[model samples]
Target chain A: MLIKKGAEANLYLKEWHGRKVILKHRIPKKYRLKIIDEQIRQYRTLHEPQLMHKAKQAGVPTPTIFMVDTANTTIIMEYIEGKQVKLILNELTKKERISLCKKIGRLIGKLHRNGIIHGDLTTSNMILTPTGKIFFLDFGLGEFSKELEAMGVDLHLMKRALQSTHFKFADECFKAVLNGYMETFGQETEKVLEKIREIERRGRYIAERKEKP
Target chain B: MEYCLGIESTADDFSVGIASFEGEILANIIDAFISETGGIHPREAAQHHSQVAGKVLAEAFKKAKIKPKEIKVVAFSQGPGLGPCLRTGATVARALASYLGVPLVGVNHCVAHIEIGKLITGAKDPVTLYVSGGNTIVSAFDAGRYRVFGETLDIAVGNCLDVFARTAGLRQREGMPFGAIIEKLAEKGSRFVPLPYSVKGMDLSFSGLLTAAIELLKREEYSLEDIAFSLQETVFAMLTEVTERALAHTEKKEVLLTGGVAANKRLQEMLRRIAEEHNARFCVVPKQYALDNGAMIAWTGVLAYKHGQTVPIERSFVKLRWRLDEVDVPWVKE
Candidate 1:
């Protein structure tokens, strides 16, 4: 199997039914007691697919699982032959990046409308294939929650990623993403955005204050 | 005999367990604890999982005196844990399970705790107090399934302990989990300032309780120990009260303590005493199985495997909201 190791899961390129697919295998750690790990794997193996289905309903692109080998803790999904949004973001001329950023933003907005929060929202997790479609991948750390704080963090994650990765034109890219996000989230976006500011303020306050000032 | 290896990495401790089709525990190993840098950084924890996960799995098999080929199933805690930590275990389990040509099972970390409680208690049917670093709840087996009766409205019990410890300038993510440290500090401390007791019907809120404690300590320069003492007292009492109510509502004669909080001896004592007072049986799993771990998954996997329930690789998904009630009981449903 052609395998690429991720920080958490091992990604393998596999062919099933004459079509290529990506297999995300959650490897087991021996450091922990046995019973605990079994429970976690069982829950997650099922959780990821449900998220994908939900995302699909929300108009996001995700690979369909061809097979789930729970005994192996592996999820085999349809593979997209495209560059990651991370790599593509670089290849995009400013206008393209802004355009793609708008699309990403809209996708995130759609996700929010469905009451789903993408736990880790880095550009690298997005894929832009030759078909020019945006496919959001990896829901290993995702959960279903309606909390505004959770939703704010989800947007904040993208903001941080854009700032850190595309500092050259972060403001523009962020604005584009925000516009797209507003397409669906509309008014709720304002609330989460405001909450995001508050969250940042709280974080900064905690960091600065030493001994009660 | 074919076996399924399970791993749990949703939080501070890492757990490994192997189960056979015969319902036997082949091996269960837990790496003590990893210190969090400056605190528990999600990325850092994920990085740690990437580094040692492979070796950890190898060691589990090595200790069990079993070969990877002998294993036919694998499972890991999927959620209700730290995203980074959960990813670490999830990635590892998926990879190894693939290599071994086995079915991968994604078990909810909380549900796994409860299942382990059921196994240890032999209660067959009982009310459950599932408390851990990531969750605090009163649950009961209903209609042949485990269902949530009451839970923390906000902030899990363990999160309260960790957040408080971090605020008090106490070492965060110490050698043991911060919960154990808080318990110990509570034992040594005396001053009990009035802390907020937020018990709304069956639901509880530790976040507010934690805020009150932090606010109190800030208002009156108090030692970390006293704050920890009061926080534990306020939160544990809140939990016990809800559990008692769950027991009464469900009318279950048995109560099992599961999850990381079950590891706390004082909490166990309180639960046992309450159960005894009601003339009900109280069962607590050994400390090893209390926290997020793999054995519970393996044990549950055996039941799933026996029922000839194999999730096709094509239809597999990780459930972020996987509720145990949705799953039919391992044997009875079939």
Candidate 2:
């Protein structure tokens, strides 16, 4: 069954090796130069599964990759049966939302600790199973970056996501994420968290320049 | 019906507009200062505005056929623009309001673009991709104001293209801008010279792409046409990705493109495709309203007046650094 036709990729639900799996195929953009399109598709298709496996190994709950076809630019990954956290966040009790944010915070701390940055960090990119386990999705934009700037940007994206979607609960949700982050990666977590504030301040400064009267 | 007079002097363009309370544009007279060279010079543009303000305002009133005393309110582009140009406009607006005994309103230039796009295109509560020479922001109406979800970190998209066109020695044709010349040249390009694509999370940075394109031109390793194609492809792709992300995040049913850069056909097509994929209605403001114009300011001023929003002469100072989110939009209810 066709799930979605995104800008760069098409997602489908299918059966692989007698087991249910999700297939992500990088769609070819007709407007792009042919050779360059193929190169980008091939590179991302191969790199995404690797990032997924790396994140899972670093204690982040992510769908397991079953098979990959670089020639076709597709990946058949474990089918995660659950609801998108984005849809369920508002229905959850305040306590549950906080608890869930803490778990997500731990997952992110692990990813950052392993030098992985999820380029797009939104609740919509996560799935929560009936068993209450969270699985991260869509590593197409993910990369390995240990730089403080990358890490800071990652957290900033998450904060923005929360603020935009769950404005009423953004503050509490972000604080829960921070609490969980500090508990897991207490050693260097302060520096990275501080970097988030610095990034935010810089963004505000750019938005309102002092020179402009 | 009450009428509002709006003055816009935010950049190289100085325009005076008159609009009825019902969103009908009566007159929009604009005079743009085209720099003989490349980019806009602030002082020169301001000087040009101060020199032509009277002519433009008089022309607007003549076209609208409305006496200055009959106007109910006066509006001006307040901030998020060149300081000197904005001050010139504010001065004219305050004087007009005081002379005509009308209320004075201060408008946010960015919000005016969105509002005018909405007024002209009938896109209610749209996810807006406001791309201009000085601004690049993807925003949606959330809470009571248009909240920015993604933006350019360094330079706006138009500036990037304009600078690249200048470096490539591309001149403006009869009436088209340098960027338009590059767009026409890109249509004949088949090769894509590789350029750096910098999308930091939801925000995009075009400085790297601009620098790389300039270097490619200096290297002469590829055709300038090919480089222009690559620049547009890379930059537009980045913009499309961010706009799509905002649409998906906001779940808005409509996509609206506004501002000067919205005139690019390639950009409009890319955004239309993305909107179609997401099952959203895609609409671009008409070409006349797409570029910087006084009609947008006039229409938005009418809306602001209906909401009982006005700036007192004492507090009507120009704010060059106003963020779109900083404005209180009582006209929109969450």
Candidate 3:
């Protein structure tokens, strides 16, 4: 059954060799030229699993890859039974939300330490299991980048996602996340935070100059 | 009926539009300053606007069949555009307002585009993707404001296309821009040359792609048709992907494509497909409204005036870097 139809891909719940798995098929965009569509789908399909494995190696929890079918531009990964963090964020107690955000921050720090940038670090991409373990999903936009600018952009995206989706608790949640990030990332935390400020300033229409009367 | 007269000289086009207070566009006359050699020279474009300002205003008045005294307000595109062009428009607007003894309204160029799109397409609270030579923004109404979900971090998508077309020695014919020429050639193109596809989260960087495309043209390894095809495919895909991301994030029920590049058929198809995938209504502003024009400014001004938004002569300074989110849109109740 098709569980979700995302922009770049479609997710289906299926049983592969008696194991519950998610069949992620990067759908071909008919509006795009054939060669370009094939190239993108093929590249991202092959790249996402590699990044997932790298994140796992860095002590971040990600779904285990069960199978990779390049020709079909699909990946069969272990199915995670949990609620997306986006759906449960507002329902959680204040203390629980803070702790969860801190853990999310630490996980992101681990990924950055291993030179992995979760390009789309939104709450919807995270799942909290019944066992209370948080698993990160969707590495399609992730990449291996050690540049501080890239790392800062990753965290900035996380901040923007929270502000847009979870605006009520965004400030408190982000503060806790930053605390956890500092605890894990250590020395580079300040620089990365500074870079985030710079990136925010770089955004178009973020007025910094004084308006002349 | 009360009417608003709006002047637009934000870029190469100098236009005047008259709109009734009831949200009806009466007349929109445009005089574009097309450079024969390169991209628009700001000072030259502004001079062209000043020279033709009177004629354009007269033509709009004649078309609308309204005397100058009948206009209740005068409005101009105030910023996020070329300084020279904005100043020329602002000057005309101020003079007209003072002469008619009516209130003056200054409009944000980007916000006008979105408001006009919504007015024409009947898209209520849609996620708008505004792309042009000057801007590439994906925004949606959130918490009483239009918040930008994604935008270009470097050169705009349209500028990237124009620069590449110029580098490839593409000729721009009457009514056909460099982007149109590229789109025409891309139809015959079969091969795809890989280029840098840079999308950092919701933000896009197109300067690298532009540089890479120019380099490919110089290399002569690929056919012009092939390069055009590759460029369009890559750039449009990136735009579509970001629009999709914003849609997923906001979960708005409608998707609106506006700005100059909104006229591209391929972009419309791509955005329509994404909207369908998300089960949202897709709307593209008509070609006349898609590009910068006085009609959008006039319509937005009408909205502002209705909400008692006006600027005094001293405070009517042009804002060259006005952001859409910074402007308060009182007419839109989300």
Query: Which of the numbered candidates is closest to the native, going by highest DockQ?
Result: 3
Which residue runs does candidate 3 get wrong by more than 4 Å?
Answer: A15-20, A90-100, A130-132, A167-176, A197-204, A208-213, B171-174
Per residue, candidate 2 scores C-alpha lDDT tens digits across B1-334 of 7898989999989999899998899998989888645788888999999999999999998999988877998999997888888898889999889998899988989899999888889998899999888899988988888887887766888889999888777666336887688788888887877777677657877887899899999998888888888888888887887888788667789999988788888888988988887899999998678777788788889889889898889999898778887777889867
Off by over 4 Å in 2: A185-213, B171-174, B249-251
Cα-based RMSD of candidate 2: 2.8
Reference-based lDDT, each prediction: 0.72, 0.85, 0.88
| DockQ values of all predictions | 0.01, 0.34, 0.42
| Superposition error at B162 for model 2 (Å) | 1.6
RMSD (Å) of each candidate, 1 decimal: 20.8, 2.8, 2.8
B89-190: candidate 3 lDDT, tens digit per residue: 999999999999999999988888998899899999999999998899999987766887788876788889999988887767558888788898988998
Model 1, B287-315: lDDT tens per residue?
A: 77776667887777667666675565444
Lowest summed-lDDT stretch of 10 residues in model 3 chain A? Answer: A204-213
- RMSD, candidate 1, Å: 20.8
lDDT per residue, candidate 1, A111-174, as tens digits? 8889887766777789998888999987765778788877776776677555445555667888
Interface RMSD, every prediction, one decimal place: 18.1, 3.1, 2.3
Residue B327 error for model 3, in Å? 3.4
